[model samples]
Target: MNDFSKTDRLMERGSAFLGSRYAILCGAMSWVSERHLVSAISNAGGFGVIACGAMTPEQLETEIAATQELTDKPFGVNLITMHPQLFDLIEVCDKAGVSHVVLAGGIPPKGSVEAIKGGQNPAKVICFAPTLALAKKLLRSGADALVIEGMEAGGHIGPVSTSVLAQEMLPELSQDHIIFVAGGIGRGNAMAGYLEMGAAGVQLGTRFACAKESIAHENFKKAFFRANARDAVASVQVDARLPVIPVRALKNKGTEEFTQKQREVAGVLDRNEIAMEEAQLQIEHYWAGALRRAVIDGDVENGSLMAGQSVGMVKEEEPAADIIAKLMTQSEDALTRR
Candidate 1:
């Protein structure tokens, strides 16, 4: 079935705009979404995004060059907003002629959108809209599209569910912002529902994390296959003064240790053993490099197995092309029945 069919009007428009055979965008994952997975996803029809989680501009340039060597299909690069050298990274993306750029991890910094659009051939900028106000602000800031992701997503997530976000943003801003629903999506029927409601498309991460072309360690892929929705737990806010944001991942030895570390820090803060700032920094340091430890080193028990609740829906490792084809078929069946 043609992805650009008129039956699903908004999805077709999204596919055309993204210059992909399908409208699905593979959500970028740190240490996981590298050259192999990104190229495979792009070549397989879905839009692939490279996660620049902690890459310096120089490293980002090298990775972008490597991905280019693998596939000629259009793909996007995801830049974390908090990266200190953000402007420099944008320069690297522009220099590489990257067609699209996604600004993720909290609201984009001021002038971020302009910096992205200022390139010789402006790249389309997509941002995550955590609230309706942020969605409007991103649009006002010149974002070409918005991804409304919810808490069910893996890694850092907002409080709302994907269904609620679609209800709130898609109906109002889908026409203007090209809204793509993310978080907790595992099946085509669910995606079909969102498109019917008004979403231009959808973004998926956990579904693609275990793709055959993904460079994740076998332990990471095995963990995802063995997990269920309930097993994917979100980090808790242990203390108000500590200022720890929740991170969703599979419950593991590392997770338990994180809890104990937070408790130890909280006790030290109470006794004035460390300043609040230092305590917060201590909490932040707990998970640093943990994702890479699991993804690259195969240390699933002690490293972060960041995966969405949709892990329950993943049963095996498959090629990226097969995954995209199955989703399209499922979506078409649902739409035709409707």
Candidate 2:
């Protein structure tokens, strides 16, 4: 085995926390992060997370089972906080003996953390904190670890940049908590920098979106391959009342369509046809469908092509093991150079 002693030592706490050889995490990309890709990442020694996006409890249960069959290495499940069946999904993960549960999309509802902890398998809870205050609050509220993502991330995102968030939150929270830095990270040099700044580890989505095992459609992978950092853009919220969360994706007809979608959903809100919570859920639901169109059907023009700024760095398809090895080797080299 290649000795990455320096880098491994830096990632010791994170690797121990994740029960993996490396502290790297392949961020959950809906439709893309399923049994094949998730298992491949775990098998490659980096942590992988199943994006349980809009899947029914039964679907999630099946997915968990399928992933387990492929690899015995540890993996995580990402559950959207706003899913009406959030608790039920938690039950599914708990029953399947999932090692970790990532509560994303928003703040986890009351008792959600407790429920995950109280389950038969007692999975660790991970939450996303957009700011320093929320990071501390989530840790205090039983979140075993935290992911602080920036606006550069694909799909749903917060307003801050990753560098800014890392600078502000790492010093204050990393000493007392397991904080994983994410968003716009495309290389191991960047990962090394974050580890040096006290991050427990790092998470990356765009870097692995087109891994050889990824199920994203050929056109979708092509879109990522052709995209430059500037080609990936964030959507604009059309109506203030709708409060639709901003989404980052490759610029395409679908990007413009999302603005129209917000207008249509906002109109429904104006007519008292749907409540605010439901309105937000509708927006979330739209993304799931749109993302599927691109990822599964290869409709790059009208389908959402969610991509982080690091899309520019993803030049070709490679096996998950190779991707992880290259990242680890680069990290080791960077650390050695230091």
Candidate 3:
């Protein structure tokens, strides 16, 4: 059994892994993890990762430089490996001197990993894996660390739940590699709990989405505040197939619309009516524009208001700095009490 009660041991190891005051990482959220939020979290003592979902190389370079100007604190940029501009995004990170680069979405290509870890680009590469096998593969492929994100995470979740993944992957992975756990992590106690469970750090997205400094639309924040655990459920029954990307969100019009669209797309396969390429393109297009409608335009009803189950615990919109401070303080308090 691991001796989790050693505070010094935990802090030293945690800091080495997370490079932050608290072992908490703000998950890279597309459209939401822009300059303000990223800088705010990093300045507040937690690792903030900027999400680079659909940005061109030039855009990513501009964003990385902008984030650096905001704070000298260490921060990271997230890239979806499947994105068409994956190589370009990696080059941007290399040029911008980004301390860390988080690769999310799909299996990272070998060339992409080599580019990130190759000489001259010392940026720590982090990848999200749902299983021990995948984690091992990523580690072997030059990933500096792994983010074991569970199914409870919002926005493109893996097939496995966090509870199961943590239990299964943490023990098998070598201690040399870092492990950050994600999915439904909200409070400081939650962070401490995961650390006790062998997680080097915890990644939080939904909680930060409700922060005052977050760019999410007011209506979107309100929806999170209104949601309870019961209100936050995955859409499994709607699609029970493997490789099902679990999405934990509040039951709303936008979610219903997405489900309906998925069903409609699935039904038209027999007649060769909807090409897989076209269907995927439409879904991607729908989400690409949908989040902006809710986040920027404040149109919650017909927009994608992606949030995790932890949203129920978020009551008010507080400053990002305050949120970070409170979480660290709370985690310390919880650890001391234990």
What's each prediction's TM-score?
A: 0.93, 0.99, 0.90
Instruction: Report the lDDT of model 2 for residue 326.
Output: 91
Candidate 1 achieves a global lDDT of 0.88
For model 3 the TM-score comes to 0.90
List model 3 lDDT by residue over 255-314, tens digit each. 788788777666665457866655655566667687788887888888887777787788
Give lDDT per model, in order.
Answer: 0.88, 0.94, 0.78
Sort by lDDT, top down from the best: 2, 1, 3
> Could you give candidate 2's per-residue lDDT for residues 241-329 as a string of tens digits?
87777899999999999999999999999999989999998888889999999999999999999999999999999999999999889
Q: Model 3, which residues run further than 4 Å from truth?
A: 1-9, 236-244, 264-281
lDDT of 3 at 228: 83
Q: At residue 99, what lDDT does model 2 achieve?
A: 96
Q: Could you arrange the candidates by TM-score from highest to lowest? A: 2, 1, 3
CA lDDT of 2 in candidate 1? Answer: 58
Kindly give the stretch of ten consecutive residues in candidate 1 with the minimal lDDT sum.
1-10
**RMSD from true fold, candidate 1:** 2.4
